[model samples]
Target: MAKAFASQGDMADKKISFTEVGRDLWAFTAEGDPNTGVIIGDDSVMIVDAQATPRLANMVVEKVRSVTDKPIKHVVLTHYHAVRVLGASAYAASEIIMSDKARAMVVERGQEDWDSEFERFPRLFQGHESIPGLTWPTQTFAGRMTVYLGTRRVDLMHLGRAHTAGDIVAHVPDANVMFTGDIVEYHSACYCGDGHFGDWGGTLNAIKAFDVDAIAPGRGDALVGKALVGEAIENTRDFVDSTYRPAKRIAARGGSLKETWDAVRADCDPKFASYAIYEHCLPFNVARAYDEARGIDTPRIWTAERDKAMWNALQA
Candidate 1:
């Protein structure tokens, strides 16, 4: 699951696992592959982050049916990313929900981002034809929105921006669990190409404010305790810090971008080398680091053309 514009497909490098982290809360994760969160309540189900296509989403739907026949009431997107939000139409939920910022990203650069991601990773979008175009949320919120599947309450909040300007988390107080989108990637690579570094750090800090007993990150296993939660946050922060420090150092000294990338790679690859999507993510990660190193805080919007050129330059 290299974050760079690599072949988009299901990550077949490792085994996939779906774990129930709390009561009626499940993390549909496959190593570093895209993960879908499930919330089953008294009356219906709520899916967090649809996979790449309806076909992929159905794989999750199939799994959901295996355990319960509850109707899926809503699809909550922590933020908008082609891989994260595209399969939303498959749920047939009453409404697709997203933060106002997430919606704006979709509106602002959805198509371009879609093209860029599709070109980068084709496997993730295996059933490309099954995707019903860009996934648009019927219900949008600014800060936070509380929805209930019968009496069970699920809180969606955009604590701050990190991975993207619209990143959010789904917290179920009763369950004592939280599903963080790309805001927390667990042991997987953190795709920061379209990210705001400072804001992303803040987002992680905000997530810690919740009294979560279990945590489901964007990818990887669902952590069971606060120690694991602490590990997730610390590892993510270290990755980000290691990436940014070199980018900043190189950019300030007016050093070569590739050199900066190599330096960061030497550092991060050693620690996260065996982590999910390391190969797929490094190119884009380096590019983003280079940009941030030069004080480019807000990640530049990625386009299909840009995707190709960047990959050729790095991987070539």
Candidate 2:
């Protein structure tokens, strides 16, 4: 039987976990679903990534209220993916920030992404009707910016391109913890649909240089301790390398997309099959890897129609 298209079959709700990786630093994770980071400062709170919709984001809000009554002052978008940014309205944060490159992507392909993702995975967008519209960042920075939440210092930097060309990491210096959006993941597949395979490793290295004590990764459990942090970073690197190498090799030989797909599965399946969204991400990852190898530097925009076409062609 043919596999389901994208995450269409993944409708069951995932159990959510809110873990504390540092003093007042929290990670809201949902069984390998997209994770959100919460950083509580002296006076207010800073949210790392917003959930898919207002209803979904309210769950995070509820979690926050349970701990403290501090108003959420800032919403920092790690990148411009629909699942990560559409719920910005829920926070009512005074400042919604994104990297300059990320904002450009929002202008270029945000709507197409919203349409594509909503079609690809229904579960994430359970409260789609509540979404106000395309989330626009109130503020943007070029390379790095530091925000002081009272006395606490949180540094947001675009280390390099990994998951997407405009990905950023939020580092809390006092806690020695980092909220690495999707630049790093633990026990979950890195969605490389709009990724830069060549620059991903270097970005990982840039993150490693921080030697953070803990990390709230994009889609996995909150990582605490230096040992676990290093392990997750390396594992993410390996996952990226494993996916790209076989696909690149196949593409170099002028192989078909299906041929590249088979090669990627042969290499990645044994290792990543049990990962969350591994199957959902494989086709897109393989397609992007193949394209990059064939000299397509920019990832093609994925629309609702394009998503179905790609899934059908690959699953055929």
Against the hidden true structure, what lDDT does model 1 obtain? 0.84
Worst 10 residues of 1 by lDDT: 1-10
Write one digit per residue (lDDT tens) for candidate 1, span 134-202. 889999999889998899999999898788889889999898899999888787888888877766777
Which number leads on TM-score?
2
Evaluate residue 197 in candidate 2 and report its C-alpha lDDT on the 0 to 100 scale. 97
Q: In angstroms, how far off is 167's CA in candidate 2? A: 0.2
Top candidate, metric lDDT: 2
Give the per-residue lDDT of model 2 (tens digit) for 147-262: 99999999999999999999999999999999999999999999999999999999999999999999999999999999999999999999999999998898888999999999
The segments of candidate 2 whose C-alpha lies over 4 angstroms from its true place after superposition are none
What does candidate 2 score in Cα RMSD to the true structure? 0.8
Residue 174, candidate 1: Cα error in Å is 0.4
